[model samples]
Target: MDGTTVTRTPKKAALASFMGSAVEYYDFFVFGSAAALIFPTVFFPDAGNAALVMSFATFAFAYVARPFGAVILGHFGDRIGRQKVLMFTLVLMGAATFLIGCLPSYDAIGWVAPALLVLCRLLQGLSAAGEQAGASSLTLEHAPDDRRSFFTSWTLTGTQGGQILAALVFIPVVALPDDIKYSYGWRIPFWFSALVVVVAYFIRRSLHETPEFEEAKANNEIVKLPLGVLMRDHWKDVLRVICCAFIAAVSTVFGNLAIAYGVLVGLNESITLWLVVAANAVALFTQPMFGMLADRIGRKPVFIYGALSSAVLMPFYLLSMSQDNELLTFALAIATFSFGYAAANAVWPSFYGEMFSTRVRFSGMAIGTQLGFLMAGFAPSIVTGLGGVQEGGWVVTAGFTAVIALIAAISASTARETKDVPTAALGLTTRRAQRVEAATA
Candidate 1:
């Protein structure tokens, strides 16, 4: 090592983002799992079918709070720093999740049971609204220029880790007798999040603000009312990102609603849990590889291919559930989710984060993606209403996933190719193209 050439590792930044996001997502996924598994019976007992819808509805309630949290937290992230916002999101998510674990069930208290759950879910959503954007922006800013996708990919890879942990932790709990499982098994996952919160806090708190943001601040060029600046200067990119983010609905269909459908259609509960665990486990390995590929090839082709392939793959996975073939179902699920969907999942952090400069990246990403994610967060209720996952059903649900994935691919295609462009030249090509046309004239 040359003494004059000091070297620092961006892996530490990636690790911090990864671990913090994993902890935060652990809290979020636990609630989502419980909503599919336990909340329907415990929170809405009056009407059996209505109970499932209500449970999914309560799951969607959090998204209502996400846009507001995005605005408030995005302001702080843009003005103060990303590190502080990341800490705030982690603590808020833990507290809300723990509170959900403590809430009285419908058997103990009637309609109020779900109402209270709604309030806690809202808090969880708010915390989550800022978590991804902050983590991705921080990681992207810290990474070496050529390695932006690789580092920001860790932020999403953390989410796969969290989902894997959530599924693994729930397996034994789901095996407990009905009384114990309902009373304690579900709550165990939520309470465990408190421990993760403590670990994530110490790691996240020590992180330094990104050099890019520091440079912007030192130069007094930070945007005022970043939301406004984002809308005025970058609304087209924001809209494109919103459509791209909507593909997240594929996740809700795969994770939460699939569990309900599997149970409804007679797959073993343990098998269902293992499906999520296995898929996410595969994602843990593949996501980083996909991200590195994005760094080399471009974010667009990888993401587009992922979206379109998932559209084709969803039917196979959904149809597999109707048969008694556990092994085949598992393979199809892993193929669709880990290899196909994970491509878009790994690429999007850099793909989206690169669309803006550091000055307003958080607000631009948070508001746009959260608003689009509102559709994803509510997909369970929507699909259920459509009878997409009804008994002896795969057509409606398959079509739903296919349509959303197609929209995402189209949205991605419309955006300018951004592979070799530096962070400084994110959304200026249209203007530059116009200038070239004028010069030719």
Candidate 2:
């Protein structure tokens, strides 16, 4: 391919990204749902009152593995190619999820069960650390400059799709008798991931590497050490992305923590799952619209609006669940999550991907977001441990949500708008680009 004349495959890239992310997160969210609704009984049967907390900790273990996975996978993704690395991540996640399904429960394995669960969860985290960063970078590079957000938004829309699928699958599982639900029903979701993985693997395999990465390779601009370059040249942006990524915690608060809280407050387990299903189903449509809005206005405004709106609306959403009004709770769930948090979710792929050049975009986005996502991964356990899942614990959850949202919004306010920036010229302010060129010359 000519360095200056690379073919963009925006639609193909978007479709591949969507399928890969949907599959990857489908596996991931299955684990999340299981942790909340099933794992305590199956894996931590002896922990008594601590079983739920331990299960949530197992959920947090993936976040712990994510940063390390980010470094290792991000390097290969930036060095070799996003498409290849994404293929690897899909397979790794599928294998781990499948193995989780195969693991013996605590009754059969004693302490070994939860330990194995954590190990599989770690592998899931490692795979996830790279999935979004690689997918977003690939899609954004393949996109037309003016429609970057809209195309990249599909990557995250895939996540909403996955969550919806996970919830839908789990709803039936949660409805089974306790013996059956615990013994076999829960494993079906994990096993189902294998089929989805095969489907995503073929779809992603058919797609080519992004044009920007191809152009960079053609011009010999591919860095020998993407992480070194990322940190030395883009540290400020990395830090900014880390803080802005805090907004992701809002998602965990809604998806996982709130589920436990809802059940504690007398909502049916299936109804809580339906809340997740409804909210994410709405996000499937709204996020793409938010992406278009960002394209028209700018990423920062949309992102900041998402952050502040989530903070303001979260308390009401949580409080409604306690009011015995399922209709009101569902409405608030849609408002807070689909309309509020989904804006940030849809935009972050582009917002963060634009903060670095093609050479280090993968590493920068993977590392920063993974590190920030530690907050998200732990939000359920941390909040629950702090009594957020107890009676009247919505206050703790709401306060935690507000703090993270404020931090994200404030961080986003300081970012330069990149909606108008050319794809090739992204991550390069004129002065910095000149400095880099001068250093190379």
Candidate 3:
């Protein structure tokens, strides 16, 4: 608002963000699926249950690298432009994913197979650190203040689309006979990411920078060191986001850990994969609705409801899988994931982005979320190690999920409401009050 209205481009921004997120996460989730189902057998055959643990550990490696990625990618995103960082992340994720499909297993390459797999996964972690942060920052800056959550919701809804695609692709691959499933079928989904990346790259290339970033540029307010500014003035918001982001553990638990548990309880692998697909597919529709609801009401209430409800509902969902009833398992999966947790997932992009000025929005969101997501990246391995995957292990898993949710809900409760804050004065800058007054005037 600095004496001028910023022109917004919500639609193109939303589509580009959605498609890029879908493509990036499609590659990411394909790796998660493979880590859960394929890698233990192919890469670490001699280690028994330990093989599964090691495979999940490799999945965690990406998260370990995410904070570093966030620092690097977030710096450039805030410094250069959201568009350029997004392009780099897309290509990096695609290349790493495609290479994962081409890696030789232990039998073919000895210890080098797992070593190479770890290297590729580290690259994926770095790319993902920036993917959602850049996409959400781009979309939020392009959207009108009143409809920010509604449009930015597409960034996460794209994640749902990605999860759905990953599960759908894995369904057939899991159904293949043992030899083919272990060998060639699993690689197809990873290779498919190459096609997705190409399509998304062209679509994303058409979008331009946000008006807000341009306005910041015109004012000569772009920071030379975004991380330094963010840590100094916005440390509280960053901590809050990290705590609130713990809610992400709900997803990794539902998507990755539950799938493994479902198989142990006699459910077919295809059915387990379908359960994830069904929940995420439903979330694709429900998340946008949750985002709209946040716009109508508030982000805090919807987000808290999501965290608390998912905490309350997760035990039943996990326990249902251990029972003889497939219907209950599917129903609980949708209830916990699609209906309960979807609200938080849908709203965080806008909620978190609105917490910082344009000068450091990308770094603030990327660093905070990626740091918190370390727990998500390692949730399955942590839970499995804590005995959450044993015969009566739903207790430990549900308890762990509840603790994480509690921390997130409490953190979200402490944030100042940004729903009414204008796009021009979204962050905690020294001029924020003056800008807010001007924006409201």
Q: State the C-alpha lDDT per candidate.
A: 0.87, 0.93, 0.92
Give the number of the best model, judged by TM-score. Answer: 3
Candidate 1 vs 3: which has more lDDT: 3
- Candidate 2 displacement at residue 55 in angstroms: 0.3
| Model 1 regions lying over 4 Å from their true place | 1-9, 427-441
Kindly provide the TM-score of model 3 when superposed on the true structure, using C-alpha atoms: 0.97
lDDT of 1: 0.87
Tens-digit lDDT string for candidate 1 (1-441): 122232334787899999999998988888888888888877887555577888898999988899999899998899999988999999999999999989988889888988999999999999999999999999888887678898899999999899989999889988999989888778888889899899989988888888777777877878778988888888988999999998888888899888888887888888899999999999988999998999898899999988998899988998888799999999999999998999999989899888876778999888888988988888998888888658755777788889999999999998776666655455445676456346544
- TM-score, cand. 1: 0.95
Clashes of 3: 0
Clashing pairs in 1: none
lDDT of 1 at 116: 93
Model 3 ranges off by over 4 Å: 1-6, 429-431
What are the RMSDs of all candidates, in order?
4.0, 2.5, 1.5
Stronger candidate by lDDT (2 vs 3): 2
Q: TM-scores across all candidates?
A: 0.95, 0.97, 0.97
84-168, model 3: which lDDT tens digit per residue? 9999999999999999999999999888999999999999999999999999999999988889999999999999999899989
lDDT of 2 by residue, 29-48 (tens): 99999998899999986554
